[model samples]
Each structure stands twice: as structure tokens, then as C-alpha cells.
Target: MTVQPNIQGQAQANPVSEIWYTRCPVPTTSGIAQHFRWIHQEFERHGIKVESIRAAADQAVRNSHYSHTQPASFREGGNVPPIWTRANGQDTVVVGITWVDEEQLILVRPDSDIKTLADLKGRRFGVPKHDTKIVDIARGQDLRGLLTALDLAGLTPADVEFVNVAGGEFDLREQGERREGRRHGVVEALLAGTVDVIYAKGAVSAALVVKHGLHPIIDINANPDPFVRVNAGTPRPITVNRDLAVERPDIVARYLAILLKTAAWAKENPTAVVKAIAAETSSTEEIVRKGYGPELHLHFDVKLTEQYIAALRKQKDYLLEWGFLKEDFDFDGWILPGPLELARALAADDAIKITL
Candidate 1:
């Protein structure tokens, strides 16, 4: 079921004198970025400053530019902000949620003899390069999903020979870097028969199966466990810096209210939303349309639902078990419900309608 507040009313006319910065992990070409872009003025109207700079999990590390930027509000695909914050001795609190269970597919060439997970044993598995050191958990999601699937099939990494395939880098040439690369190198590797089996993500991956006749051998989306789902690229959490959460919670609530409004607007205008995303990402309309699928249509609620907390804890535990975490912290304490709670309360009051 979808949940959205009635945002057709007027936004607050009086602007509070507070300067706050917000950032979303979605690339400029993605739907999330488009929605954020559309609501830029709305956030400003509420006296909240929006940080238009796009920050990736790879860049939100200790001593990185994103970490130093100190955005008061942020959104990320996984439990990345929490992980990075804990590792860097920085304090941040997660306040809002947007659940999206993404699809990660295990594919094989149509002419290949490999037909099932069992057939993948002793075969060359093409893995797009993933950074697992201090950052880049976002890129590692598919790899972790692939590993979980292998384990479920009574296989291990030792059973397959891993082939390295080029993937996107955090360094953008637009920032005047010398390197330029495509993010779909895995698709290229598969088409060229560089590997026997591969793990692919999003619309481009889906297109390979539909148009190029690649065989989808294993569907990770079929798995029902939250442990698997957490890493599948859903459960986007909106976080706030600890100081902001404590010092100026009202500003944080107002920021979250704007996010909810944007989601509601997008829900009511799917066509425009899709077109905006397609144009921004330089992807074809068809690819952008199919990329969202059912996962991205979920409710963007600010409440810290019980299911969300459980899924987040499961992710933290699994990451620790997999040695991805250096140490454990209080996962429960990482969530602060005050701002979202305040936002919901404000939305319920008809005496106070929000104006854009």
C-alpha cells in the first residue's frame, strides 16, 4: 500500500532563518535526483538549504569531501551512512525511510551450456569490480547478493573462478579527471563471452535478457529473506547529522516533509517523472521506464516502521558477519525518530497546511 500526506495545501509562508544542507545518493540521471531537483524551491521556501552536490557511497568515507561537507540531511540506498559514520567516528542518525527492493539477476549467454546455479560450478564467473575497503558498499550490493545465492545453492567462491570486469569509478571526468568510462562494462563483458556467468543490475541488465536473448539463470528477487533483501538495493534511509538531530530537529522535520511531498507529486505524475529521469541519466525512455519496475514505486514514508528497523539491524549484523565491518556499534541507537515523528504530527494538523 502507498502512503502520502495531503500536500495540495499551501506551504508555510513564514521562512525560518535556518541554514541546512541536504544531499541524495542517487545520480543526477536517476528518478530520485529528478524529484529532488523538482522540489528545490519547495525546500528553500521552508528555509532549508539544499545541497545539490551528488554524493556516492564511495565518496562518503572518512576524511572525504562528502564527509567534510557535513550535510544536515541525506539519503542513501543502503545502511551506508551509518556504516561510514561509525567507522569514521562521526555521529549521524537515520530518521526517514523509502523502501525499494531492487532486482539483481544471475545471467548466462543464450548459447552457453550453463543453465542453473549448479552448472555455474567450476565456470568462470564475471564480477564487476567492487570496492569493499573503507567505502563503496553500494557497488558491493550485487556481489554480496551473488555470494548469498551461491551459498544457498551449496556452492562457495572457491567453487568458481572469478573474472574481473571493469565497472564505473567514483572519479568523474566532468570534474576534470583524465579517465572516462562506462558503467555497463559487465554487459559488454557478457556479450563478448569474457565470462561464463554474471551478476547484473537495473534496466540495462533487464534489456540484455529481453532484447539480446541472454538467459536469466537465477533470480535473486525470488528470495524472501530480509537478510538478502537488505543488500538488494532497497530500504533507502534519510539520515541527519547528530548535531542537527539534537540542536535543530524542527529544521530536519521540515526537510523530511519536503521529501514526502516530492514523492507524492511523483506518484501523481509518473509519466513526467519517468521523462525527467530519462533525460537526466542520458538513458532512453524505455530503459528508464523499465528500470523503476515495481520496486521504486513504494511509499516514501518518514516513519521508522518496525519492518524497517528489523531489516536495518539484519543488514548491520550480516555486514559484520561477512567481515565488512571493522567493529559493531549500537544499531538501535543509530535511529532517531524525533524528526520524523514531528514531521508526521505536523502533517496531521489541518490548522497548519504546508504551502509550496
Candidate 2:
């Protein structure tokens, strides 16, 4: 990030302004970056600026050039503000895709003899990487809770293996060799057919599947049931920062409205959005198509409800227990949702409908 001499002080716009946002590439592309771009393109008046840069988590920390960025989807959980800071009981919302199982790959295998999450006992569990494990807790971040839940459902990791693969990074490389190097040279070492399964976001899973011939036997979408997300249930989450929330309430409201609209639009026109995104990055049509989820990632259930808040705070407490946090953070003060609520109000108003 080059230091642009402060040519202009506090150039941030009034009711609207451009704000840089970075997303960590856990599997392949960034869910957060994609989530916001449609917002920026569909709604520019709310002064929300969007820069969907997909960086490795390590690189993202080094280049904190943006005014605001989403928490690493797989963050280890920290005491940092915005992370723990609360504003009017609504500071930010966390919404992303997750794949839950009793024991990772073992429990979530594409070709397994077992039928449900309970089938794998004493089996192995592997994620694409460590952060993937961290983000698993976004629903609760509680390893024990997850374990217990799995047990009740019927399984135990004490019975199997655990592997960590990092192949998605190759998708973002100056060339794909870096990614291929890890998948073929390193990951292949463990694929002697002993490992049961692997769990990763759509992009990551797709990368390995396309590159290494891995297949997904179980589509978390199998049951007649809708997929479940911890923090933001059916509607999903939209975690925004606090400083931006109060100082520019107007911008926040408009930004929220635009983003929500964009998310809706992306569903109907994914091919167009994917093509535009692919043109800018080395990502291919296949990567974009595979990385892209249902119009709104239909697999998972999302919502801005109490269930979501409880899930977020539950993870916070678990973070404290894990010693990743200094102290317990209050849910009432750690997150802000004022702008979202305001936007909902406007969306409901008949008077506002004429202009919309």
C-alpha cells in the first residue's frame, strides 16, 4: 500500500463516500468482497465505496489499506474493538458460508458408507487450513459444543485423522502454479485413499475437486431441510463497523439499502457478475461458477434475528474460554445494526416506495 501523500484531509464523503473493504480468501474467492461489490454497483448514492480485494489472510493483515474490512471468516477470535466493541447494541453482523459436520472430512465425505453426520466414529477430520476451523465457530466457535452436538448426532474425532490443506491460495496467485504446487506436490501425499473426507467452502472444495479429482458425495443441501447458519439464520448476516455507523448514519442506511438490493440482484444475474469479476482477476469461468452459491447462497439459512445474535455472542464467550480473548465481551455493546433496521424501516414505508 503506497502512502498517497495526504493530498486531502478527511476526504471521506458526507452522506456518501468510498470505503475500501478487503476479504480473506479462505477457499478461493472472497465471500465478503463479492457480497459488497453488488452493493456498490447497484447503490452508489449511499456513499458506500467497494474494493473487493481477495488476499490470503496473511496478506490481508499486512495490507490493511481499507477503511473497514470484515473479520477473517476463520479468525482465531481476538479482543480487538469492532470485534468486541458495541454501538447502540448493533455494531456489525457476521454472515458467511459454512460447512458443518461431526468430524470434518470424515463426517462430511463425498463418497462415504455412512449415511448421516452420525455415521463416522473414530474417523479423521480435515479442513483446507486452520482458519477454516476457526470460522467453524462463527456459528458458536465452541469446539466442545460442536463436538457435543456431533456426539448427540453420533460421532467422535477421537477415532480418526486430521489434515490441513491449502490449495485455494493458488486461485489468487500471479500464476496458478503456486496453488497446483500445494495440491499436487503436498496434498496428494495424503490421498493414498486412507482419508475419509474434507470440508471447505465452495471455492476451496471446488479447487481441489477440479485439480485433484476429489468429489463431494454429500451435498450439505441433501435433506429436504434448509441449510443452517449460526449467526444470521435464514436472512444471513451483514456485520458493519461501529465508527462508520454513528458518524454517518445516512450513509450507513443508504449503503445497507444498496447492499441488500445488490445481494438480491446478484442472485438473478450471477453469470454477469461472475464474468465481470473473472475478467478483472485470473479466476476462470469455472472457478467463478463453482465459487458462486445459490442466488444468495441458498444452501445456508440466513436471517437478521435473535437466533443469529445468540450465535455471534455464543462464539464470543467460547473465544474467551479458548483464551483467544482477554475477557468476555457483551453482545449488547459489541455489535451494531441501526443502519440495517433503518433501511428496513424505509423499505417498509409506502412513501419511500415511490422513489425506490
Estimated TM-score for each candidate: 0.76, 0.57
lDDT scores for all predictions?
0.57, 0.39
Writing each residue's lDDT as its tens digit, candidate 2 over 162-243 gives: 4444433222322233222343422453365445544433344456666666544344423333222221112223445555
Identify the candidate with maximal TM-score: 1
Each candidate's clash count: 6, 31
- Per-residue C-alpha lDDT of model 1 across residues 208-252, encoded as one tens digit per residue: 666668888876766787556566345666666777666666666
Model 1 poorest 10 in a row by lDDT:
172-181
Q: By lDDT, who's the top model here?
A: 1
List all candidate RMSDs to the true structure.
6.3, 9.0
- Model 2 compared with the native: what TM-score? 0.57
